[model samples]
Target: MRRPTIKDVAADCGVSKATVSLVLRDSPQVGQVTKQRVRESMARLGYVYNRRAADMRSQRSQTLGLVVTHLRNPYFAELTMAIEDAATKSGYTLFQGFSRDEVPQQRRLLETMAEHRIDGLILLPAHDSRPEDLLETVGAGQLAHVLITRSVRGYECDYVGADNVRSGVLLGEHLGALEVSTVAFLGGAEGSSARRDRIEGLGSGLRRSGVTSPLALSLPAIGDEGGIPLVDRMLERIPCPDAIVAYNDMYAFGIMNGLRARGIVPGRDVAVASFDDVPDAAFQQPPLTSAAGHPEIVGAQATRLLLDRFEDPDRVPSTVLIEPELIPRSSTTSWSGRA
Candidate 1:
């Protein structure tokens, strides 16, 4: 049998096809009585609305696209969940893509989402590439876009991220408070905004306490297995570092493993601290002292910003920076009953 259509429902209800469309969309413009009548007619005629077609006609997909660099990273995973929850609550659905920290992949994903007519995009850029080109494409396609966790260098866009600099400063101060003279920073790619800001903040914070400059070492991207070799190199240095600050909990874990292989216990022999308080940070041999970025808060804020852009395309882009907190654990303690 032929599927019942909006025309059939309209005919049965003695109303225009437009009325059925409005009723299906739950538009407030349609009177409650009329909506009930249309629904009854739809039920009687077994009518099913074509949501995609309706969305196309209305020029609003009511869907949001999310692009993240690494799906395996706990921070990104938590952020994804928070964004999904907020999107669903706001009567929108999410489509996610993982870019694997590659710029080309990120660009391709943005193009694909734009082609699919998503209402808006929430992107965690792979690096400091100007997103204006992508944003212009989305705008030309009548879609809205926002940046989350990572921001474009020159272009202003709705962005939600933690104050990474502040977090770094806090970490440095914590280490300085312990009077650890020599410290090393490990992990993160070169030219990464998070890396640059964090290192600067950490150095400045340490300087505030009259501590000398801390040595920094870059580790390979997350899960790249380069941390093993990097740790080996650090160990070979004359007079190894007294303390280490990792880019994130994952890197800290790798560092800890490397320390163990060298017969050096993390907390007792050399103190360690990092960022992103992932669940594992708390369960490590000696719980990790780290800076916590509330991914859930960032995700929700990003969703709201994107939704606002979708609602008002002409609104100016805004930047929202959430502060980070420190989670002190056993990782930074010394045998002398000091942290």
Candidate 2:
């Protein structure tokens, strides 16, 4: 069977080969009418563009590398899929890797992806990652990259992520309206930018509502522990918090589990809330209250920033923060002592 080529498409569309090539490249010079005609002709001729041949001629890979922290996290998982979707639509193949919040692992992944000659990279930096850690791969001009969801100190790049500070403020205000006093925060590793921003915002919101600042505990490592052990530590404080705000839904789930283990119902005994309103948040036993980060939006925006950066390498770095909205559910609203 003979494969249809650009020549056949051009012939069918009554356009020059150059015009067909322009349409294939999605150049702005091609008008919509001409593009439509070319596409229709392509469909009729079963013409498929040879992206690999085009890449070779252009000296480009047409490939992108994406490294995210904690792929198992539902929010991150959703964000990754969204990024891939956006990249595929833009005619770029995405290679994905999970860093698991480790600096060494993340550095290795970045180096490995760079070796493939990717056109660009999108990263969610690992906990405590320093700018120097990426010097050899990204900082050395080997590849252009965008930061997503997390930022590293001294590393400036296009970034797209949730407004963690706003997320915490929204959560705090909601809890304050419910008359929840003496709140505590659990989960997230110490020194994470997201955690620091969220904690700052929570404190601001609490103080604005005449509530005292929250007691924050940064876990050294996040795992299945789910803040089970922190329950006792919080209880032992001078005044036990009536409510807890977790770093994210997963942490909230763990705290809820721990509370249940102590014969304490999340909504009935102590209010619980968290960030990132993943799908499962609404289906929990008590239905968790959460601030929705909208990872899909973050992912899409990050891809846009990276694509734009590729188009204009000399442009200044950009940062986009998608605002979060708090979703109140039984977890916080059903606080037994709410007055």
Local distance difference test scores for all models: 0.79, 0.83
Q: Which consecutive 10 residues in model 2 have the weakest lDDT in total? A: 215-224
Model 2, residue 260: what's the lDDT?
86
**Per-residue lDDT of candidate 2, residues 34-114 (tens digit):** 999999999998988798867753776878999988766899999999999988766678999988888899989998998
Question: Which window of 10 residues has the lowest lDDT sum in candidate 1?
Answer: 216-225
Candidate 2 residues lying further than 4 Å off, grouped into runs, are: 1-57, 216-224, 236-239
For model 1, the superposed segments whose C-alpha errors exceed 4 Å read 1-57, 131-142, 216-226, 335-339
State the lDDT of candidate 1 residue by residue for 45-103, as single tens digits: 87776778766657777788999997777988999999999887666789999988777
Model 2 lDDT, residue 252, Cα: 85
In TM-score terms, candidate 1 sits at 0.79
